[model samples]
Target chain A: MENQPILSVRNLTKKFGGLTAVNNVDLDIYPGEVVALLGDNGAGKSTLIKCVSGVHSPTSGRVTFQGEDVNFSNPIEARDRGIETIYQDLALANNLDVAGNIFLGREKEKSYLGGLIRSLDDKFMRDRSAEALESLHVEIPSLKAPIETLSGGQRQAVAIARAVYWDAKLMIMDEPTNNLGVPEQKKVLELINALRDRGVPVILISHNLPDVFAVADRLVVMHRGQKVTEKKISDTNSEEVVQYMVGALDDTRKAEVVG
Target chain B: MTDGATKNIKEPGKNASKTILLSLMQVWAWVFLACLVLAFIVAVPLVSGSSVSFLSVRNSQNILVAITPVLLLGLGQTFVIISGGIDLSVGWVMSFASVISALALRGAFNAGLPLPLAVLAGLAMAVVGCGMIGLFNGVIIAKLKVPPFIVTLGTSFIVRGMALLMSENTTVIGLPRGVRNYGNESMMYYVRGDGGGFYFFQKPELTVELLRRMDRIITYPVLMTALVVAVAIYALKRTKFGRYTYAIGGNEVAAVRAGVPVERHIIKLYVLSSVTAGIAGFLSMLRFTAGSAVIGDPLLLSSIAAVIIGGVSLFGGSGTVVGTVIGALIIAVLTTGLVMLNVPSFWQFIVVGAVVILAVLIDQTRDIIKNKIGSS
Candidate 1:
């Protein structure tokens, strides 16, 4: 899993007409490693992630996955390529149950008479969904309970489990623990660590320095849509990372200072 | 783990019972149940002192015939409302369908066409015409990004004006005997004895008789309503399309992110809704044997009211087809019962208005309860 980087972004830049939201960012994420992206508000972290996740096309440069330069026109295409984004909203329908939300768009069905009519096999979906949740160690009370009834942490777990069940290779989580309490945050961090142990490349976007320091193997700092600095978590301190995030350190300053 | 799983199953059962009881106590359920009771109460008085004769049967058949088309139209409205849209144009579409089919039949029958072919032509015209209007509504809403309410409201005027123009604001009658018999012919065949004894059954009294009686009681509209309900339930519960509908209704942004063809689904909903309205129109013509420009006047409010009463949320993503059917039946029973009780025609409006308000209140209460449970 650590032999090579699974996803490589080279000189990727995104501009919204007059505003350059993301500028010339290069990142390499390897399998079984956690990369934390940290920035203040409007720091282009979301824009950069959106470019990679196919929510928005990069204005310049390219995203290479498995050594192939690829462009995604939509989220579905991006998801089809084993890149899944877990947005902060979780994007789950509250009215639907766990199984229903898990298989929202891509539902499995049994066909009668050589595929003339398709029928939903509820039993199969329920069993498979239970297996998926169990694999993630998410102890959901029932598959029939609507997601709205689940705790915040459980909802986040379900969203993560859905991505894992779909065989996502590169998982991008945006502020996954922002709204969670201390214990829930601990649960999600553990889930992220578990994901890494399973050889899934995880890109964590967070503002909590302690959270990043706890789990991230590498840190990428972006300021004003540009990659200000990149550092291995072992070699860098929170003060140095904060300096890069607030534009207090430039390339020259970075060279003068050794971590 | 075993204890956890046991609690899981047991808790939902307990919650479901509570929910069912809560739903029973809902104002809509009470109103609907009360209407059924009122129907029986009125029936007793209306038939009192009159021979316990075939008159009751005939009246029941008449009520069914009148209600069938409304039921079909209401079913279509239920789908639209469940998806978080409205279709005021259904009534106009129904009128247009009937008028166009009547005109087509008059021309085709005169040209020595077979009766079945003529009937098919009438149905096709209605379906195509109403379906096109629905498609137009979908296009305006999805492509042009117009709110469904404004688009459908605008379409209602356009369709009504078109129907008026087509019919020249006049009644079109003189449909052939075959078409007339579809609604006019007695569904039941009875054997009468000279001792004032009558044996009421069906045409064959064996296979065809039961089938025929069922057909009469059921009617094509009733059967179509049932089919619509079944299809809707299956789609909403089982199909990917149904899932997407709920998803989109729940959150359009999330649905789009999940790769749902949001625009396409919304368009299809509108088109199917109109198609149902068209079928309802043809059924109305079959029952009445005439197509007037104003044949669908009573349908607009009734259909919307039925769906609302059936537990469909005005804001999409919730409700069931069964709920809508119950709603339509409630309206049908109430209207019939009131007429039997010799209630003033104007007073029926007050009754319906009160019921609609009560249904909406129940819906809001249910929503609040669901949210409270969810949040907890």
Candidate 2:
């Protein structure tokens, strides 16, 4: 999994008029490690992910995926290249069922006579969606149940399943455990670990230090639109991480090693 | 992990059962049942107080003529409403199409052209004009970001003004004989033996014309309405465009995020609505054999009201073409029944207004119930 970094961002910078939202940050996410991006609000964490996810193009710098520099015009292009983002909102249509939401834009079709008579392959979709969810350990009662009926944690699970189902190599989750209860958060953490076990690279963005400590293999701290420090989880404690996140860490703090 | 897993398994099953129960009690089910009963009740008067011989085939034929155009217009309105937009210009578009066709037949444009070509010209004019108006509405909503209500309302007045100007505020008459024959034809009949005595009577009895003049009651427009309904149902239920319409109407922001070309799909929906209006216009022209600027005035409100009353959400998404057809039938039956009951025309308007209000109230109640169950 560590043979090559699947996604590499070099000196990526984003500015909104007068403010520097993300200032010359570089990152390399490997194929299997779960990297937790930690920062307080206004710390430019979201801006960095947004740039990588193609919601916002970087103002300057290169985003190279699979060893090739690519510019995504929109999220669709990013998704097509298997860079799936699970936004905090999940973005599932509440009126549609789990399978419907999973295959929202990229719906499967059955066609005959040179695509003249087209029909939805509902049976195939239901079966495949069930297989995907079951493989992910997402215990959904019915694929036909509307998304609005699901709990927050279940919804998050469905979102992750959708991303994974599309064969996304790099999964970016933004504040996934924000409003969830303790058990729900644990479930998400378990799912993240399961993803890493399956050789999927995960980028988890969170304000919760405990969640980060529980799941992340490595930590990347941002302070005022810049990468303050990057460290392996075994080498850093919560206090040292918070210090780096808030821009209070000294040079010695950056040099400290625990591995 | 075990507790969380157990809770998750328990909740979805409960929620699914609740949803199934709620849908069973939906107001649409009741409205659908009510429409069937009303249809039966209305038919009773026509069949009662008269011998089997007293019922005329022409009366049944007249009912079909009155309902066909409205049904077509209702179909167009259903599409627009389901897409979360309204088209008020359909009536005027129909009038414009009919008047232009009638004028064209009178050598307004082509000299000695065949009737079919003239009719096609009328249809094209209606389709292009109404479609443009609809396109304009969609552009304003998509690009300019104006509300659909205001855009369509403004276009309604503009279209009516155009229709009036095109016909010179006068009725265009002298339609071609071929076009006139469509409305004049009757497609159905009832046969009865004509005799004054029983078959075994000792004395011979004089013969009477119990049934006569069987004309085709079902016209081309009526068949067209059926075709339109069938196609609409298929398109809305089976096609990607239909699914996207529901998705966008359900949640526009989510749809856009999902990479749906939101603005383009909406524009197409508007275009489809107006094209249907154009078709309805041509059919109405054929029915009346003359086109007046005032031909589609009542239709503007009636068609929209029909779709709404039939159960298409005024808020958009989650509607069926079948519901719209039922809605059109409801309006037609109500109007015809009122006339049969000798109810004043003014009273009929009052009753329709009441029904529309009731339908909307029922829809709102259903939504509230759904949200309650969903949240729980």
Candidate 3:
């Protein structure tokens, strides 16, 4: 746990005109650990992750990945640097097949006529995509069916497969298990553990408390645009975490002297 | 083990049959076209009592020639519609191209340029000039955030006025005599002259006997259109450009998030649409040996109708160039067949309009069934 942090954020803040969505936040994510980010609605959980994922630029602060400061202007830049964020919507093109979504931004091509013409290498992509899904023990009956036709859990597996195939160093998932059936939620929890075992750190933003308790090594709770408390899994229970989530507990203020 | 078993459950027999049915539905237009041709063949013999053969080579050539321009227009529309946009200015874009090409050709010929060079200049001006107009439409819609419908409609009116003003409201004529020959020349001619001679890749002199005996006509324009169609099919099905077009249409927000350059792609689609329209205009100009401001006016709606009839969704996301080809053929056959039967030409409009609605209804029903199968 004392090894160098893979990602670190210091004094990060984001403001939208008159409102402060995220304020002066400091966080660090170490390698090979699942860190759950728990917060109630409008607690800036999504905004904080969005800033780190390059969806929005922080109003002020610094984000360091692999010990180098990064200011990503778009999601692609962040993804190229080994940061994969699965948004709440999953970011899958509904009309595309599973393999197509897996290779959405970057596609494989076979060139002909000394590079004059390049055609999509769909066979290679499908084979590789199948390998990726198999490694995760995810079963999809058809890789050619459009994403819209897939069940919710299957879509989530495809998104996770994309991150794995790309060898993402850091995974940020927002409410990944939401809207999923109970069995599907268990599958996702298992997948998070698999990612951690492979030494890829994950920052999971979820409202599901039992899921956090089941898979996370540590937890951070945010309340009203501020991180109120962070605790080891053994140090805090769901009741105490809920207290921090609803703004009933404050660790930063407790450290401030009453002078 | 339960997780693996639960997810791996599949009914192979049902899924396999469903996949076959789904693919057949996707290609229903081709089936519809085959049935149409068969019906016309049967009706023509019954009505005319073997006098006018509907399946004759000459009539087939007529239908093929008639569809070239409309097919070109529909090719471009297929791309635009698949990318979730519309280009209403395509007809005027055709007119604009015709005028520009005719003017360039006449100007170059008067300047003592070689005949081939003059023709090349006409083609270059027509294609490049219309491409510029396409670029204008793209920039306004993508950069200024204008709705595609409004932007293209506005450009249609502006281009219409420009074409009328440029041509001074009359047909532009006075091209070289050879220009007319280029339009009518076929690849091979069989002449009954000299005791039945076959002229390969050359137009033999049209004596009364040769005119009466000639049955095979495979023009250069037809070959050129074939090449374009082949290339268009390859591009839409196999290339990154086609995939991106579908992705943008399917869910623009997801495409953008995936780092697809949406605005740049949109601009390219418009440019491609206009270029095809330009080609159609240039071909028609060659076919007529004259350019009229109103040449493409009636064709604008027909082009869109062809695309709709081809199974392309107006809402975007799914379509194929092959489907468009069959759709154009359907309209061409209907128009030519109606004239052969001596029905009023006005009936062509009502029939084509009705076909458009029918095609869309079938497409909608197929989609509903597909959804059901997908979910089940």
Tens digits of per-residue lDDT, candidate 3, A93-140, equal: 888898888988788999999999999999999999999988887888
Query: Comparing 1 and 3 by lDDT, which wins?
Result: 3
Pairs with backbone N, CA or C atoms under 3 Å apart (clashes), candidate 2: B186-B215, B186-B216, B186-B217, B187-B216, B187-B217, B188-B217
lDDT of 2 by residue, A1-259 (tens): 3688999999999999999999989999998899999888888999999998888999999999988898998888998898989888888777677877788777788897999888777777788888877777768766787777787888888888888889988999998998988888888888898789888999999989999999999999988888888899999999999888778983334455542
DockQ each? 0.49, 0.45, 0.59
List per-prediction Cα lDDT, in the order shown: 0.79, 0.77, 0.88
Error of 2 at B237 (Å): 0.7
Clashing residue pair totals per candidate (backbone < 3 A): 0, 6, 0
Real interface contacts reproduced by model 1, as a fraction: 0.44
Candidate 3's DockQ: 0.59
Pick the winner on TM-score between candidates 1 and 3.
3
Per-residue lDDT for A1-259 in model 1, tens only?
4677899999999999999999888999998999999988999999999999988999999899977899998889999999999999988887778878777778789888999778777787788889888877778876886677777778888888888889999999999998887877887888898799889989999999999999999999999998888889999999999999999986535656865
* 2 or 3, greater by DockQ: 3
lDDT of 2 by residue, B4-71 (tens): 45143346576776567567546463565466446546564665533322124455555667767677
Q: Per-residue lDDT for B204-291 in model 1, tens only?
A: 4445434333324455555565676688778777777777777777777777777778899899889988888888888778767777
The deviation in Å at residue B24 for candidate 2 is 4.6
Best-matching candidate per TM-score:
3
